[model samples]
Target: MTECDDTHGCDTISRRAALTGALAILASATARPALAQTYPTRVMQLIVPFAAGGGVDVVVRVVAEAAGDILKQRLVIENRGGAGTVLGSQAVAKAEPDGYTLLAAPTTMVINPALRSSLPFDWKTDLVPVAMIAKLPFVVTSGLKLPAKTMKELEALGKTRGTPITFGSGGANTVAHLAGEVFGLVSGAPVLHVAYRGEAPALTDSMSGNIDVMFSTLAGASAHVKAGTLRALGVTTAKRTSLLPDVPTVAEQGYAGYDLSAWVALVAPKNTPPAVVATLNAAVNGALAKPEIAARLIEIGAEPAPDTTAALASFMAKDAQTWAGVIKAAGIKGE
Candidate 1:
């Protein structure tokens, strides 16, 4: 009789625990969908960290248009350019993580935290990566009149020159700027780093011979390269870009193991509902995979690298480590 009483008590405890577990699961399942469905009840904003007409801006516009179509809402782009993207980044960092405020950020999103000492928000804790949109290839472009035709020849020129070659960057603490410094460190050359407000001004300076050389994105500088204004010496990736198929990669051009491919990605504030994040990620992945989107990206010298939130998180973490090493090696510190 005592054994029976004990057994009945055990059963009662097990049933109670089961009932509690089921209630918790039901609550979680119900809450997530409700939160996701209520998201973006108004117009959505896509924040671009750089000025308009830049490669990032172009990629953001493409995705924003497609996302608007998918979400049945007007997705607008807000340009908030300053402080090597800190101004814009902080804006997104502070926004409510409801899937309504999105950030169309670039590789600087990773670079900034490692290089800059003062930041308004912590990138790791504040931002949640949604997806990777495109991988941007960098080309070593020179004015048409410059004599260096290849990476080898360019390195030789820099070595022979009594002074450091002045290299223009899209901005201070940007991937382009860091690439120039990395090349300098690896090749044993003195590369004078020059910071520009944006890629357009830098490319313009490169085209008109105002700057000696620069690491310009294929998407932003290809038109000038094709127009005979700027000459492509070598691509800054491990493999040659399709837009400039004939141009050899920096590694192929005697700079072995050289690569610097920046990418554009979508991110939002943290704690956004998994379902809405999943939905946006799927839409972005699908749109990027479309032949039309892929072709347009290729035409503009951008490589589509679409992936889910998990993949993007891994990629972003790896990118952070890579840029951290580069920043330390180059001794690049922010103001």
Candidate 2:
């Protein structure tokens, strides 16, 4: 009688334990979707890795404002510009991966790792791509009297000039700098680089005949090109930018296969929930698809590029590899 009573008690306890385990699993499964649904119950922050009034900053604010409406939460912009975008980037990388903090990452994030051995964060591991917001084409602009209207003429001048041709950029290892180096490598022209505080100053110096040319931003140089102060020799991308439709591409100008452009994307700190990533991606792509949003981006020289997170990841990986090769060949170093 005693043995039978003990077995019955043990079975009853085991059944209760099993019931508890099942309920716990069921709760966990439902909790994640609930968390995603309730995300952004408050304001979120977007870190712009550049200063205010910059192209990236403007582009991010436009889309962020639209996305805020969709999510019913305000997305605030904070500019933490310093150390070649490293300061702002590290701020986001170390932020809590709770989907509230994000980085308005530019192409420089990918190239910086390859250019410098030590960085506060590892882009590959510390940050993850959320969405590809837009891409802007670059242009090769020269002073009106630089003695070269086309890239071929420029190459000949480089050969004949007593000193190597000087190409100025906003800073060392920036997209403009790399594009300038690429031009030299492909054309076999002896080129030297001049780094300035910013593209505006570099373009200023180029206008004064301090530099031979500049692989520059179309947005910043377009007005001068239109004003006849700066002559745009060629567009750097594979296709010509509509903003400067009259200019030919470097490839079309007989430098075939030479194509480059700068891009911007949204990135999040590591370990941010996948559901959060999905939500942000949807918001960003939706914002990009809106007609007004697209128009605004176009007005600023950015091509609206709404894409899946997976596509962004693949594109960035390939771009990083390409930049690594270019930086290595050009012997590019950090600022």
Candidate 3:
């Protein structure tokens, strides 16, 4: 072969490499839509960042079961509870940005970042909201041994008692814990926070009178309230919940603007295809729209709060901002 100029040979090689890269990128872009169109070729994993049988797990199981049916694909739930949801959340955050892996994130998704100084992953950048499943309000419950029957009475008792009133939470930086912090902030009571592995244990301690009070999700605390083991003082919502319509709201109980509820939403790893997000959102909303699912959610003390992806993103942003202020003001820290 004839000898070639050094610049021409190098330029030709560079042009070939550039064209190859562009073609590869174009192929990836074209493949994503097709992949999204036929998503869930196999079973998908939905991670619940809480222990099994807890409020979030229960509600997510229900919704996922129904949604899986709608999608005609099996949605396996994987409970990866630890580190106040940081463990499981980070798993989802770092997972492949495909539709196969999803997260059933609760209020702690935002609260954890708010209470902690640094996280292994960035909540704002590592995860993307897909759909909002439900809003489960907290019920301020006290053991029968506590000498308080209402929110005002509880506040008064905490103030007048010689010893600091003890409040139990699922864990530090959890929604229940933050709710207790908010109570302390507004009520000016000397409250002691006792952290446990999970809500079930803390609720058990509350019922056994080891703890005086708990700001628990309605699903976890309603049974005890109905059985008269724990007395419900008020719900942590702006309005009364259908599950406990007789009980008043914390906002109405002299703590205006104390509307904190544990909400569950579906999220995927960042950069998941938009088409996949839309598909999953539609599936979730369809499941929530089912009459039986809605009724069951209500019975379990959750309200089906299906929303579009954009709306869920806005809601999550606002929620994170609100809790950031609360955490900073109350000097809350992660464990």
Candidate 4:
């Protein structure tokens, strides 16, 4: 064999390696779409970043079956609640961007980063929106004994009693908590915030007249309102819900833009393939559109709001902006 020059051999090998790498990258790029097409070869995990019996968990269980059926695969829900949803969310944010692991995120997903500092993942970028599964607005509720029936009435009563309005919430910096704070800001009232372990206990206190008022979930407050244990002053959404059509919205009550809602969304880790995102979004929307499924969600207080991936992204961005303003004005911090 003829001997090769050292520099020429080195250059030749380097060029060959570079070409091999380029071809490998090209092959990978080519395979992704096909791979996305055949996604969900196995069970998919939808993590509920709250306790098993919480609102997020209930919503996930409601839609998981139909969505799984749509994709021809099983969707498993895993509860990883702790650190105010950080523990479970971090798992999803750092999970492989392969579309298998997803987060059934809630309003807390947008509230946590601003309420807490130095989070392990960047809330703005670490995860991507896949679909908005359900949304339900809060209800301004009071105990049967409270004289106030509207937000303004509560404010005026507080002044007449020579005391600030007492409001209880599930926790500090929660959507309910901040909604009360925002109500105070817009209504020009001195509001006292009492934090409880969860919304259930706070609502229990509200019905007992221990607290003057609470911004509560429509689901949690609906039964009480119907039973005459709690009075629904106003809905916190832009418009009244059909379930409570007779109850007017806070916006219609004179706070023209005072609207807030609690919702659950589906999200995947950053860099999850767009084709995979599209597939999952379709699955979720199909699941929600079913009449039985829609009825179930409505019974639980969340109205099915099947959404496009782009719309979900815009919704989350707007949600974050809205809560950021509330959090800043309230001087709230996380545990």
> Number of the top candidate by lDDT?
3
TM-score of 2: 0.83
Best-matching candidate per TM-score:
1
Question: Per-residue CA lDDT of candidate 3, range 124-170, in tens?
Answer: 89999999999988898988888899888888888897777799877
Please, what is the whole-model Cα lDDT of each candidate in the order they appear? 0.83, 0.86, 0.87, 0.83
User: Each model's TM-score, in the order given?
Assistant: 0.87, 0.83, 0.86, 0.78
lDDT of 2 by residue, 1-335 (tens): 66347887878888998999999999989887777799989999999876665556667899999989998999999977767778888999999999999999989889998888789999889999999988978888888778889999999999997778899876667787789888888898899999765566787888888899987767667778888899999999998888888999999988898988888899999999988998999999999999999998887678999999999999999999988887887666654
Considering TM-score, where higher is better, how would the candidates rank from best to worst? Answer: 1, 3, 2, 4
Question: What is the C-alpha lDDT profile of model 1 across 142-250, one tens digit per residue?
Answer: 9987778887777788899787778887777888888888888888888898887678878888888887898888888887888888899888999888788888988
**Cα TM-score of candidate 4:** 0.78
Q: Cα lDDT for residue 195, model 3? A: 81
Candidate 1 deviant stretches above 4 angstroms: 1-31, 333-335
Clashes of each: 0, 0, 0, 0
lDDT for model 2: 0.86
Q: What C-alpha lDDT does candidate 3 achieve relative to the native structure?
A: 0.87
Error of 2 at 224 (Å): 4.1
Clashing pairs in 4: none
Candidate 2: RMSD over Cα atoms? 3.9
